[model samples]
Target: SLHNSGLSGHNIKIGIMDTGFDTSHVAFARMRSENRILTTRNFLDGGNDVMGVPGGQRRHGTEVLSVIGGFDEGNLIGTAFGASFVLAKTESLTAEIQAEEDYWVAASEWMESLGVDIISSSLGYIDWYDTTQLNGHTAIITQAADIANQLGVVVVNCAGNEGGNIHWRKVVPPADGDSVIAVGAVNTDGFVSYFSSQGPTADGRIKPDFCALGEQDRVAASDNGGYGFDNGTSFAAPLLAGGIALLLEEHPLWRISDILANLKRASSITNHPNNAQGWGIPNFVNAINMEPYSPQRSLLIITPQPARDSVVFNMIFSSASTAILTVYDLSGAKVQEWDETATEPSTVIKVWDGRNRSNDKVASGIYICVFRVGDNNIRQKLAYFSR
Candidate 1:
């Protein structure tokens, strides 16, 4: 995804409020060495050691950080690996190892003091609350989250993983905040995970702003002292936060609200947003490139580039005759050919499976597709996915 845009989150500072982080973790070593981590704070005791007190050493915070900045080439690479960080240990483990609403609010305020551009909280509070408090403005943390947004900081929270199987099936606390970028979890095929919290806050507004791959999501595992996988909306939140950092790097002059609006507009399923997936998965490639495509205005539209097996071409024609469609390899060798008779002025959609006229599969690479429609010819190039 980083290769799809020029943004690497450079010059952006992100604040992560969670359980104690493993400062020794390799995911943060390079950044720390380069002074990427501006500072560390243990909000629990107001100290500089972000590892928290004692038994509070759960590896969850380490895992969360890995999804945003961990890097090891082919082994693992985070979405915002180039961004700076300010780790805050806001969780405690004396009893159940839970972080309270007061602690969360305090962390947000502290992050604000540092003038951080983005804040990611994979932690949620529910000790004394009931399902009815899922309203957008009820929870203390939710209200604080909104205040943070008003102060020009974008807050990213995990839409609690209590969907479908739970009795109280709604997003939690800060995730319900109107301005918070509540992130939900989805499987690889884009289906909402059964455990990802459902949206449409008690006030009837969709909670999660977007969804991302979270089930069995890969991350830098503190357990292996290397790379592994963990599943939760917790993992999803940081992944999205990293994307926001990269977007900020590109549009440094824009406000957080402007960035949010553009991202919602560039969602994979932009036209239709639902409670389960909010706007849908944000296509950062489109967001950074400003490719707000409209089916009506585009002259010729080809889709699913780097497509496997098949590709589709949608073209608008005023009048037509015999349209010759040919797919060619880089060498100008004709691979796949199609001849269609268009009798009138109409829009036509064509699908092509990667193959040659001789019934042989074409090797994976860039292919030039030429559409000779009557007297006009349209040429578009596409890429095939395999090696």
Candidate 2:
């Protein structure tokens, strides 16, 4: 059925960062037969040892890769059937720590060099062994994310599965990186999984930007035998990554940020976003059919670094029309609204006194400014700091 519909993730290349993959596995046999696999690298050992445990540790990466592009019988079908892949082993089965994060950085750099369309990782780190070595802080590792974004590669990461069980809540890096699409896990019924991490990052940005089915999902096994079912934010993330690969195939010219913005826009909870489901579950079909996103003609903050009390929003439009600006805090609660009636095509500067409509100073954190001009809407994030 995956091939019958002609949705074979074709011409798209995805870079996967995880434990080693089982190259000899059956799920990828067709791809190997067709030479669809682009390249394989092991950032962990600097060797080409990508086969998981030579036959044992292959299950995890096999399942992850299958979720993104595996093809099989009536059992399960991946979102991107035509997509090719490059495997980058960044995690070690023995230890998960800050050093793994460094390996991921190296892997991502390699992915960019290959001009991959997307980077999907089922890895996240919250509590490293050495807290001093932790790179969860926003200021530290966001640069890596920024570089990936600038290279026109969409980065998708999993929010850690630590919500109900852990004290240090929220997603891990590079999921914590503002530019990455930090994904959370939900079930077929669309309920947030109890183990899905919660967030409003340390800098106060709503994370785990979207959710996907993670519970009891079918995945390919490295045994060259059959499929296995599992649950984790790991499974949820690749479902989205697979869907994104399809979207990119359809809209090749769209920027990574535009794709991300449209995904957030087409999510199930565009209006009622929260920490558990940032923009909610992304709708792949809707994202593909939607109008092409033009970030330039929408509302944007051209910067003075972080917005102090007053900030200017550059408004761009092709036709003269009325524009409405609404500001919301990290909790998705509306704090302010400004209306500009029948404005000409030009830039409009709107200032907030760092206070809510009730004349109260809003707490220092991250806020979203949404601008609506006719049917086109744009949203931008602004950081607020208070002494």
Scored against the true structure, residue 109 in model 1 reaches a CA lDDT of 79
Give per-model CA RMSD: 17.9, 13.0
TM-score against native, each model = 0.71, 0.72
Candidate number of the best TM-score: 2
250-285, model 2: which lDDT tens digit per residue? 776566667888998899999889999889998877
lDDT of all predictions, in order shown?
A: 0.78, 0.75
**Per-residue lDDT of candidate 1, residues 133-252 (tens digit):** 778788888898997786567899999888865676788778998889999999989899888898788888887889988888777666556777889999999999999888778866
For candidate 1, report its TM-score: 0.71
lDDT of 1 at 313: 76
